[model samples]
Target: MPQDRTLLYAGRGFEVAHVRLHAPQGPVWSDLYTVASPRVVFPIGRTRLDVRSGDDTWLTDALTAIRFGDATAYRLRPETAAVRHSLVVSGHASVGPTHGASTTGVSVCLMTPQALYRMHAARRQLPDTDGTQAATLVASLVAYLAGAPHQAPWHGAVARARQLLLSEGSGPGTRVLSLDELAEAVSRSPFHLARRFRQQTGLSLHQYRQHLRLASAMERLADGERDLAGLAHDLGYCSQSHLGAVFRQAVGVTLGDARRVLGPAGTGASASARI
Candidate 1:
């Protein structure tokens, strides 16, 4: 089940969307620690909108604190057709239910690091915005979100666990995180720890581990530093054979095939394509 990426075309406007997504509820990250969704941004369009949350907070593009009043939308309408990436960071907040191929009509597309860098660099000529300068703010918001990281969390311990994985790679061995060990590190009992971790990350322990492992593997493959055997060891798989099964199943590509995504990477099929 992938997120919706269909571009909606109406009489006077259209939405170009792409981005990877995981809900606040689900085991989406059960495999290994997962990479936060990559950054995907939309260009600010012709109609600037004033978005407000139920809490009375003005919805800015994701960069600001999401309460910066009118500074959330960027007002830039370039004259030509140069492709640009705007960061998005709305919709990720607890919004509402979503289903099928129909667009739920929200904003924010988590972009990959590469996409973020590109968007920031584009700022050199295009200028910067919080979320309000545009006639249309969605693109501006997409820009604001493009370079940001997803740090939203209700509990500190779960975030601490994620930070550890981020700073130290996956685990002791490929597939090697135990609940008791994680609890010890986070200073909570196993049951309480697991519950909080799941609630914060929207994933089970096993799923989080697998997601982390795969993200690590993706990084290694991009660097052209390992074959199946080495990747397995680096990621703690039992052997190259075991690695093959999990790797393909997790990423939808064989180890050999993943190695080729290096140049231009993932076909520039913006994370928007996934949303």
Candidate 2:
């Protein structure tokens, strides 16, 4: 595997780096690395890698954020040839689990659509200075993650259902299956799937799908997509107006404002959106 990174910002007590990994045609293992300072990572782009910290393993992707504290040792083993992008924030001492401050292991959490959008926009802008601004952003993000509730491990049908939903619903052009379809695909009754899914992830099926659609919209808008009507249709919305309404309600900014800031060669415009 070949990996590269670029330092985007450096501050008094925190710094941000954009890291990328490129794997060969087959599975590969990276050299062991140890964390020297507390850090949080926001995964970007398409990602599929098993993070091994001691005997525990965690799967990380676009919808997940990972935190590692000082002295943590870990390695990456990619199951296939792929490219991955991530934002690594180091020097922040409070990036550990929300419940307590044991810095020896890893903490992974599901990122809400708004949180993911903020991270994606930040990566797109790639500010090279302004430590004060960077620190503020990092602190806001850490606090948001800390407040978000965590779920216990999910398995069996619930896990399979989640996998199907994320994989199929994340695309800009893919329409998510209906509840009946999803339940059948996951080998469970609709009622059973609905209850178990909520119990496992603390989100209804509809809510999770909405998150996927919104995340897709943010990613494309950040990439400079301008066709609101087409984008809405592709994402299974009734129309452009429908998408606009939901986007504003969830992100606290209009689509036009978001596009202006997250467009190609963004002007570094900041939004009042939730951090």
Candidate 3:
């Protein structure tokens, strides 16, 4: 079995990963991922996926899109078949999948599967384009995936606050606003805003900001940014060690291990490939 993982796009409240696994009548492959927030998974080929958490298990068909809510630990196993898949992880405020569609806190949606396959093809063709074009395509796709209809009131103050945080938390050099500042902007008391924010979004403001910073760091790392100290400083970390500690805690892997698994950064031509 030969497997590869690539970072396709990372911005603000979300990041997408392209993963390929080639297992031809080989041993079953399983991996554990720490899910801090909601994520959606799309299998590109005819492959079976078994997702488990503790006693809960879900068997999914090929080419189906699955959305999972905040899970502490998740185990993913693939059948004895080759497969290529895309996974998108986003902050809680962006995509929240309710239960009943699948297992608890997991939702299954099937809308425009053809469009998704076309997007996958476009990602394969992205390497041929310039950096600006690739970035734009990625952003567009992310926006589409995150563009689920709002289940809550659109004009609600909490919604506006969430949007403000998401917009400001994207990219590097972001400084999370204070509680007072956020409350003032949203015209709510600090305590009320904090409580409402947490109620609406599964994550607190500080936790959401950390998630964004980590996502940005992952993108820079994939683009061949290797200077840990510089990357830390750019991300507004006090020091490289601080960034390392947070990465290890949140991702369950050290920076060195991630770099080794990702291999060297590829040229734009090698950005996308099949198993």
Q: Write model 1 residue lDDT over 1-275, tens digit each, in one string.
A: 12333232111132223332223323221222221332233322111122222222111221212111111322222222322222233333322112210121223222333332233222221222221222133354343543444323223677556544443454334344467877788888889878976664456777666655665565455435546687787677778778778766655556665554432243323222221
Higher-TM-score candidate among 1 and 2? 2
TM-score of each: 0.43, 0.82, 0.45
Q: Which parts of model 3 have CA positions greater than 4 angstroms off?
A: 1-155, 169-175, 263-275
Q: Each candidate's root-mean-square deviation in Å? A: 14.9, 3.2, 17.5
Supply candidate 1's per-residue lDDT for 244.
74
Which segments of candidate 1 are over 4 A away from where they belong?
A: 1-151, 171-177, 263-275
Q: What tens-digit string does per-residue lDDT give for candidate 2 at 124-191?
A: 55562344554576667877877666544334777778768766754355666889998999899999
Provide backbone clash counts, one per model: 59, 0, 0
State the C-alpha lDDT per candidate.
Answer: 0.39, 0.72, 0.56
lDDT of 3 by residue, 1-275 (tens): 35677776555446666767665653353666666777766545445555666566554433345666777466666654656455454552445464334345555443232234334434444434443445454455444544432122224666567556655643255657788998999999999988976675455778656755665565455445778888788878888899889887776666654444332443344433310
Candidate 2, TM-score vs. the true structure? 0.82
lDDT of 2 at 105: 68
